[model samples]
Target: MLRNAASLSVTVTALVLSAACSDDGREASASASQPTGVSTAPATDATGGTTDAAPTSSGTATSEPTTATSATATASTDDPVAPKFDIGGKDLGASTTGEGDGCKKVDFLFVIDNSASMEDNQAALIASFPGFIDAIKTTLSEVTDYHIMVVDSDADGRCEQPCVMDNDYQEFCSPKNFHACNANLTECDTTRGAGVIHPVGLYSSNKKCQVFGGNRYMLPEDPDLLATFACVAQVGTAGHPSERPMNGMQAAVSEALNAPDGCNAGFLRDDAILVITILTDDPHYEDEGTPAEWKASVVAAKNGDETAVVIAGLIPKPDLGCAGNGMTQGAHWQEFVDSWGDHGISGSICEPDYAPFFQQAVAVIDETCDNFNPPG
Candidate 1:
């Protein structure tokens, strides 16, 4: 029910899900389409319901480059508009002195891979994760600070397919609804039938805030969000449990490049930038080790330099990824992802398009721009 997408360039969008009820008649919400003002955040009291953030390194940015990924905005239909900058560069003394200057701040981590043949990518992220927060609040209407997590890298605590584990995760087990019968009260109690998918939106960016979905309890992007979707069902969504393949965007870019040292955009905010997109058609298999130990687990989940911008869609390309049509080989795991594009890892092969692949990944977050601002 989700593959619908209006897509791109600074503005003009739409997302609709609205269906109510949920007590006996059975029906929750998915509702979308709303872009006016924008400022959301708040709704996390996690504690082994397991929010597990905690990674804080630091650096910075503003903006003003020209040819790296070629930045331009202003396309409006619902939201793309962004342009008119002081996005600074040459490290302009680490920029930002005025109203968040061209507002960089970003931290998005989605390391999804639900196994069990990924049950249609976990039902396309439970019906398009509410059009991915309605395409990021229709292009950042002040995302109140932005922080979204959606892990399932072979889950950790409960849920194998209607869970009830005791792996020492302590209390709050899963599976057995009829009102969790007694789950300390009632945050969720659907008998644990909806695993292979948790790690939803995790609100806190601006104006409206809330996240947690797979069946529904709270899913707001903006509509006066006061805080709700805190369902927190952390587990392996389905069953790929052979273990040893958890790269959940290298643990959400090491918590957005080690955030904390002054923390601005929730993580550490030296202009803040950390975006990992990892969708999956399954192919990073890595035989558990040895491609130099799986490229050293992707360079230790990219702890190298600039920090975060992982992008790995792998949807349904392979006709040589038709832009001009390109596909000599590579589609499964190893060979010709454009011949490994010299291993630097640029992207292209998109065709399945679930909302223009989240509006071209929110217009490729210019880590100070140099190439993909809109290039790929």
Candidate 2:
């Protein structure tokens, strides 16, 4: 059973702290074509905060219980001013990472919360992932480079950490239409148009990929990220959260910026404008517990290269408690809107279908970034 969840408020408090951290990796762009974001605010005291950590389980790997200490950005950083948005105002006081315009390439990493409650959600997510890539594919018809990192809270720390890579050290798509999968991976069924993936998802069990035969599992069919599955079930434990999200966010944006070998990954160009799309059911709190966490995630994502963040909150839009409990699970997304730095999109999953929720968000983001190709 869910460990005696922290008392409702206590649980919310714990979840909140994990979202806020003092790690700032900020940078500024030399041109208006680049984007920048920062992660430095103040260290948070995760003490007494609730643990959304998934419980330990006998899985493919040893679960590495993360500790949420008062951490700092301790990395080469950037500091850019925020960007424009449709809804919220920009937090003039908030920090950012980089600056620039558009990007030609994009290395997207989708980090999902796969706790028990997310089981069905995860399936839906997996089913829908290829769609996002497909739409992106339409815009990048000439480019075929991409990568994915799917994180599930429950991972065997020793064998496969929660944030382990599916295609680490390798690129995806093809050189010719390479945006689907690298030339090496052909098992993928790209017939429906999702396109094959290169460098494919890697499983911790096969580090060198000798056993599974890199080509055997690296294909791109219907958004298969099973490589990161075993550990996706180890969340909701009793300790603390993690700090890698901030780091991962940076990596994704970096890929979007410089792309491969100083060249854009294939979309537009390494220096092409960057746009970020975030979908979460929870809040990015700003309290001592969560503000830092959310900021860190944002910083990693922006890295200032002319990035635009579009947040889609799974929770329906409410008139009140935006700064408190209701939003704690879905933190600073509102801050982004308020700052006019990021557009905040919301919907009620209470309805039978979440498509409208997703569509509305996609629409808002499309309008803001001026880049969107709805599934035809």
Candidate 3:
């Protein structure tokens, strides 16, 4: 009797497994009609399965209600509210056009360290400049007055110097004299001679443009923009080993604003916006007082109006990834950036691509301005 009972139990278990494995679909369909204590979501009928069929009193499948799958909507980054402008940290605010005279004046001062290590980075900046101009013209729109200038960070203001290869006194001298001098001399006035290339903002007045045989205005629409930018930006790969970009910038601006009928005359205006971009790989001292004092001078240069000036830094970031074998973040420069608050933006100089940084500068300028519209 016990053996018979055991054999019967085995047979029952086999029959249950066979029913569960069967593909008839009636069991699944019937289960759908019943509900357990736990709440569950409705199921949709799949292909090869019965469509919303219910279990009848006889346990046969019957027609039941069905639910259609609902489509979900996703937000796209192309939306108007999507963030568009970014520096290293936060997204810049969107720009709006306001009521004003049609003319919008923009002055750009680029203070670049022309040290031996800057050749490759300078090339990268020039390569990425077209995009920067386009971002200002196309994105910012109708800038009536736009002027650009370049200044070297060689701040020693030396006269004739020794060969840059021999001594490190390449300070404030032009790179064009590196071949003539046997040893780089510290006291030579670099602010003179071939090394002190004229600012591009004063292209018409700059004799170097004539020397280079370039046309009158090297504007964005000019055909010889590459040659023009190359000439102005080719400040040489032999500048002071301890470059002071802020000092160089101060000297450049001072020459432009102070000189009687200066070379950079008419470039800066009370109504126009002023922009300064400093590019370097290594940190240097702030010679003219603290960063705050220098910032005050920049603001004062723009008629004591902070709104008219914007300063951008494209130097080594405050990070291990940005500094290199012989370079580090410009600590005083970072302080200057902090002084400007929203009026300033920064990017990493170590980056091989400069388009993003250039674009960010334009965007920050746009945000700083009350309105983006140019004159009618």
TM-score of every model versus the real structure: 0.26, 0.38, 0.60
TM-score, candidate 2, is 0.38
Candidate 2 segments whose C-alpha is farther than 4 A from its true place: 1-103, 139-144, 152-303, 306-331, 336-344, 348-353, 360-376
Which whole-number lDDT from 0 to 100 does residue 41 have in model 2? 12
What does the lDDT read for residue 184 in candidate 1? 34
| Alpha-carbon runs more than 4 Å astray in model 3 | 1-93, 97-103, 155-189, 192-223, 255-257, 324-329, 372-376
Please write out the lDDT profile of model 2 over residues 248-335, one tens digit for every residue.
2333344443344321133222322233333233333422334345445454445533234444433212222111123233324333
**Which ranking of candidates, highest lDDT first?**
3, 1, 2
Off by over 4 Å in 1: 1-107, 111-149, 155-157, 162-221, 224-245, 248-274, 277-287, 290-370, 373-376
Best by TM-score: 3
Per-residue lDDT for 1-376 in model 1, tens only?
1121234222222222232221111223222212211001112211101111111101011111211121222344443432211111212111122222344345555544433233223333334344445545544444345555444454332332233444411222223331122223211221121111233211111112234332222224434322222223232233233322334434333443244421111332334344544443332332233323333444454443232333434332222211111121213322211121212122221221133334334444422222212111
Query: How far is 60's C-alpha from truth in model 2 (Å)?
Result: 36
In model 2, what lDDT does residue 203 have? Answer: 19
Where is the poorest 10-residue window by lDDT in model 2?
8-17
Error of 3 at 219 (Å): 4.7
lDDT of 2 at 87: 17
Q: Cα RMSD (Å) per model?
A: 20.3, 19.2, 27.8
Q: After superposition, how far is residue 166 of candidate 1 from its true place, in Å?
A: 6.5
Candidate 1 vs 3: which has more TM-score: 3
